[model samples]
Target: MAKKKATAKAADNLTFLKTPTGINGLDEITLGGFPKGRPTLICGAAGCGKTLFSLEFLVKGVEEFNEPGVFIAFEEKADELALNVTSLGFDLKKLQDEKKLRIDYIHIDKSEIEETGEYDLQGLFIRLGYAIDSIGAKRVVLDTIENLFSGLTNEGILRAELRRLFQFLKDKGVTAIITGESGEKTLTRQGLEEYVSDCVILLDHRVVNQISTRRLRIIKYRGSLHGTNEYPFLIDEDGISVLPVTSLKLDKPVSAEIINSGIPSLDKMFPTGGFYKGSSILTSGTAGTGKTSIAVSFADAACKRGEKCLYFAFEESPAQIIRNMKSIDLNLQKHVDKGLLKFYASRPTMYGLEMHLVAIHKAIQKFKPNVVVLDPITNLITIGSFSEVKSMLVRMIDFLQENQITVMFTALTLSTVINDQTDDGVSSLVDSWLCIKDIEMNGERNRGLYVMKARGMQHSNQIREFVITNKGLSLVDVYLGPDGILTGSARETQMLMEETGQVLHRNALGRKDREVLRKRKLLEAKIESLKTEFESAEEELNKIYIEDEIKRGVLNKTRQQMTDLRSGNKDI
Candidate 1:
């Protein structure tokens, strides 16, 4: 099954022969890379990274692909070019010394060009060809092609030279990149140059809200499919990195496994015990509702399980986050020291949303983390509009889920109205939405946590008390008072009142039982006494009857004496 997916993954590159531009994320955008043995045009405004993009392509080719490259500069000197790239860790001096690279700075004097009365590339082609042959280079770059059109008055001659320059690179069988200044109406200053190139890329530098961002778009690629969307690229110490959009198919392999929410009670809320692997989770709440606590718990859990976690903090510094988490007994610094957790903190206004997304994409690709946390994504809305933030989040979630990495991001709900609705910021894009809201009553604000939705699992509908103690984060069952589900101090107060009422009820029941026993004992004593008195009276009555019987017998005996005298003759 995996083999089939792998084959399908490579199907996009099967249509053509290409040379890989080893810049991060560029190969995926081009599906294979630039077209082989063809000149590609990169046109952008000044300081838009057109030159760095080409230099990175050449340097990466030489270092990674073992392809020697020649860079022919027309705007800067060879030493200046080499010095400017040293910050990117490109050892140009060493590469040139090893004969693996060549840099030729062709001085283009506009005055000399006007005096010469011609715009031609034969002499320049000879030098470029000699440099390529000297190092057996397979890659070439012509930085700032606008210099060739500096003083040209005849459009036909400039057009012819542009065709010859591209044809020369193609004839030499080397994949070439030519950088040019963006024209007001066309892709390059020389409007006809883009027509002759096999591929044309446009770099854009846009500033929104005083924050600058760099974007790259592929205008056209002949005979090979390429992404036409504007991809965000970042230039750090390593060099240019373009964050390519995914294949845009929902064909990523799914996992049946479930991972915990790092809080045991929160995991118990779901029937599967936690979130599904690679699921996107959104934890949203008002201020001080423990949203960051949830993120910290997840990072701590991932690190505890020996899995890497990347935490992107847009508000606090790394040390501040670490110290804040420590109050909850979560030692994040230990995870940092162990290299299992990484924190990337940047202000939301540091750059446009696209560049932040690029940084996130680059960081995830480099760290290969098992999970990621974007603490409070609502801060991103300050830099971009709501739709732009949502769009950026859509792309970010797509990238994360495609990698099968679990992501738990927090969103702040600033609305004062308490309702059943979750903060709808990116809520539609997540697989699970954990809505935490403030239940303010009894002069205190308490957190009530409930699962708004958890896809593919049975989850609890009842809200729980989202507790954050010094030991850690936990969820306890909220109280059901007369008013309804009670939380925080009100819930505790209700519990105490009910406990006191139960104690009083038990004591009353015990006292009533004792009194009933005492009354029953008194009644039994009275019955015993009455029985003794009745027995004594019956004995006295019997004795009187015996005495009366004796008296009657004596009287009868007197009478019987006379009668007996008569009867005695027969029976004395």
Candidate 2:
């Protein structure tokens, strides 16, 4: 019976151990959420998204987790809070009417309220407790706890009551989130972090190059492992979205299926006839080097394969991109019309890097594309620092690759060399890098394409001439001649010159063959003449011998006539 009781106690403790904040990536960073039944202090200066973070925690607990929540607002009123969050599509009023939530605004103005000596916050405690019990709340949020100190004159009472309030919430077994203003030297204004010390999260808002970025950092989380790095978060229409800037575990499954790169010539470059599915492809080049052309080709190819594609253009409008792609015969508008392609055009300066990331996230969730393309990612550098851009891109790449989405990014380089490329510095992070360069020859520039890296795949090493004709984009072998690698008119001129040389060489070989045949004929005639002459000489010699024989016979016949004994003639 004692063992059974101890087991039950352990189970109960485990049940109320941690609560998920329901913020997008916050729960993952916290390793679960804030400690259950303990107060977590969220401190920041004005407009750092502190209140929104806490409100979201409570609202999500009620809506998503089905846990009733109590919101004791010390700054904004119930109506104002609801009105403020309506834009975020959080129907706070509806949640309250459904009895799943309770919002009580406790306004404490320093000028309106006069604090008497030796007074405790028993009234505040009663209100909070009644609110909690009325809804059977499991989550509580005290937004801007520093406001409570504004109406207090005695620091001793304020500090003591603050500690007691936290303890009371803990005693009630309700997970609480306390918001406070950031202090100059401390984590929270009025040192509220010193009291409600279970976990402390600090929010920071900084401006760089006239653009604002919000960051969230966990100052301390006692008795738990949490992400300590500063994560860039955004407070947009969707509420707080914190991007965990840690290197994600490289456990995402790699795909073996090869996807065509759209251009047949380009596809032939890869040994697999295409790129690996869910791999990141980077096409970087200088001005007018066909970076966008290559990206559009990829998107067109994906769409032609009946896969959805999302194109994020930072420097061009949708119409502009569509129009420009038409010159290359990509026909991006047709894909968009068929709903296989989606274009999202926006300026990089329109929002901070985090907000842009959030927007992209939202778009991805909505579109659920199989492929994503970002044209001219270098424009993003104008709005953010190099490291910031790299971090956001890393998070995005990790997310996309994990979801098995093939991503293509186009970066514009200021120069031709790879080392002096764009500051985005995503070259090493990508799976395949296709570098486009301007091949200047014969006082003209032509585009050349080469694969700098393709992880886990064999690709072509030779630079091919990239041509953008009205028919489509094509890659041809760059002409290598006596001078060097040739392109443009030089390549064509050299090609013609080589053809002419081949014709001349063929003619010379034909002439030599004819000359050899003629010499053989002449030599055969001379040998035939010598044989005829020798035969005539032999015939003449035979005739002369016959004549001599006849003459000797006649003489012998005369002698035989004289002496009839012809035996001598027979012997002769």
- Taking all chains together, the TM-score of candidate 2 against the true structure is 0.83
Query: Any residue pairs clashing in model 2, and if so which?
Result: none
TM-score of 1: 0.88
lDDT tens digits, residues 386-419, model 1? 8788888988999998999999999888885644
* Candidate 1 ranges beyond 4 A from true positions: 1-15, 110-121, 151-159, 192-195, 418-425, 524-572
How do the residues 400-439 of candidate 2 rate in per-residue lDDT, one tens digit apiece?
9988999999988886666734437787789999989887
Q: Ten residues in a row with the worst lDDT in model 1? A: 416-425
Evaluate model 2: give its lDDT.
Answer: 0.87
